[model samples]
Target: MLLELHVWGPAFSLPSIDAQCLATMTYFSLVLPKDAWVLVASSDPSVSPTNELPALRSGATWVSRFRNIVDYLRQYSGGEWDLDRDLTGGERADNIAFSSFVESRGQSLVDLSLYVSSQNYWDKTSPAYGAILQWPNQWILPPKIHAQAKLRTEHLGLSSLDLEAIREQKDREHSAAVAAGKIPKTLIRNPRETVSTLLSKTSQQNQFRLEALTAEFFEPLESLLGHQPYFLSPDRPTTLDCLALAYLSLADIPDLPFSWLRDAMRSKAPGLTAYTDRMRRHHLGLEVKVIDALSATSTSSTSSPSLPWQAPERASFATLGKTLYDTLADSTPILKHIRLNNRLREAALAPHSGLSGKESKAVSAYALARKHDLYLSIGSVVVSLAALVGYMAHIGLVGFSLAEQEVPSGTDPDPDADIDAVVDAGQVGDFLSML
Candidate 1:
């Protein structure tokens, strides 16, 4: 039986680079039969039991969430790719601590970069979502999604601080200090109100807070990654690597505001960048040239012209029209016949095709039902199209009659009086009143 991994579709980049999606992709890439597994890019989270993505389907069994899916796959694959298999007791403890720290702290940073940061969220992340969704959903879903992210960020206490508000408070403090004739020696020396200096101080404080949170994960990671390629083991990549690589790869994303995290890792952490690069190559098969091109330092001229990670242009009205055309074609008699014939051929070659008596009759009945369904689908489509066309035509005729009644026969309307001009002249209201 084929395996299906239903994940959030790519919008901004390939394999989604969504933390959970990347982790799932990494794990499956290592162990699962690539030929037998199919990746379905799902826009609807409701399809999953838990209403979240990175869901796995093995035969009839459905598994949701990254941890659950990993556990399920471990048992399903008979422990083939289990990283914990060879770990000592101490190593297991380290693994647990590291994984927890990375999942929590690292994920928060990822969330901040992709959702909380105004530049990253609005310009890069929101548009990425809009590209994947259909009309109305494209318009509606992004704001709702962004609001939810903001709420989550607020829960994290990261969204609570307002830099502008902080600056204003600092200004008030300086003013009060001057009014009381208690100006600090530092203020006297500077004598000027430097917003930049104030902002820098606030920014440094925030940076320190971020570093403290991330150090819980990265400090251990950097120490462990001293000389080795992988995190715990020497050769095999583990779950920790999957988790790390997912966020680390975001360093390459152009115009990412929270790239300080990636910069910190690269500059401070030993072998971390190399480990993620190796993992990217090993699991994703992304070319080194492409990977390097996507890195923070690479210039536009030096970067590759195209990469698989880059999403195609967002679907336009023309694409929607094409989709409607294809949908109509699917219900046409010729396409239906072709599809039915293919199904019949597959049914004939099926395992129980040669079976006699009841089995054979059931197969024949199934094929007959399928043929009927094809015709039924086509008929329904035709009825729908006719109804739609008739309704539109009726609306058109009504609009035309209304226009004729609104305009007098002798009236030579000024060419300069366009719709906007006419509306501005109150002529539109008069015409409506006449109607």
Candidate 2:
């Protein structure tokens, strides 16, 4: 089948690392057919998340609207996760490529667009999406994650589509243009959205949504393992893994120490501690601090630790779970990739087919784009590192600006002329099978 694989990247993979997105994208990329129209909905299309922008080549269509994708998906499969049912090999590969770019929906803490885009979605959903959700009262079981998808539909009100007049009004200005697979204008980080400003903007409903999700969806699951200190079980991982993954992954915000429950991790019965350590080594592909930062804090600093965020077992069981994950899931791949470091790694760069000559006129344009990518990811590493170890020069944490110009070593093709004839298969293959 000629596939119209539409991606409504409302909250793309670039925002965080997500498990389902990882799994689904992997399976799809490895198995889906070629020549599929992979429509990627990004608030900004010019900003490529996959790193392999490759000038859109011949297969992909980047876009930016949630409803547009809903309409597209309606053309293929319907609700309740029918995405990976029976896809071919090429179809699976494209899905993996798309998935590899999704941002983790779970804990992309500063996702301001989720708030700003509502200024558009709620203006459209008439007859009320809430009404549709309530039609089946028996299905009113508390939703898995934040469950904000229900209320947010009001944001996608039918006013835009003019459901009553959609068929007749040819010149209507509906938000469904987003569904057409074109990038819409969206602000990445609302300049006004400081940590304090964002906290203030959080509606009471958002608080309840988060509270309910934490108390109901996440806590009980954490409760299952008793008051242990870690989440991993034995030598293998469960299908239900990735729940607390972000809580640790994003804990790199030094000013804000990690606050996951410690007792559950420390418990020896089910034995979570060792498993967590091992998973950090395996899945995350990064080093994790297993020892409680709180204990380390008190012992290391004669100066009392400034922040109030200790592990849950240290005091009252204060819960902080994600409401965004359920809404994004398979929908936005780029944002999911951003949430996880799956997008981060050193690899041999591929020459874009866009290059016409040994030194095409487009070199300047391409260099600028490469510079932007370096700053966004690699530059962030320096910016996040405090001046407590300031060794060089420039902006906020801007010591190594020119250092990025260096070509990556061990990856230069000329260095190894002997093994150059075969088609190079990248991480795409290995990443797909894992899903």
Choose the strongest candidate by lDDT: 1
Write model 1 residue lDDT over 249-346, tens digit each, in one string.
Answer: 65433345445556666676647777776666666544322222123233444322222222223446775675456446646977757565556645
TM-score of 2: 0.23
Count of clashes, each model: 0, 87
Residues 213-330, candidate 2, lDDT per residue (tens digit)?
3333234334444544332233323222333333322222112111222322233212334434443444433321212122223332322122111221221122111223423542
Each prediction's TM-score versus the true structure: 0.55, 0.23
How far off is residue 311 in model 2, in Å?
Answer: 38
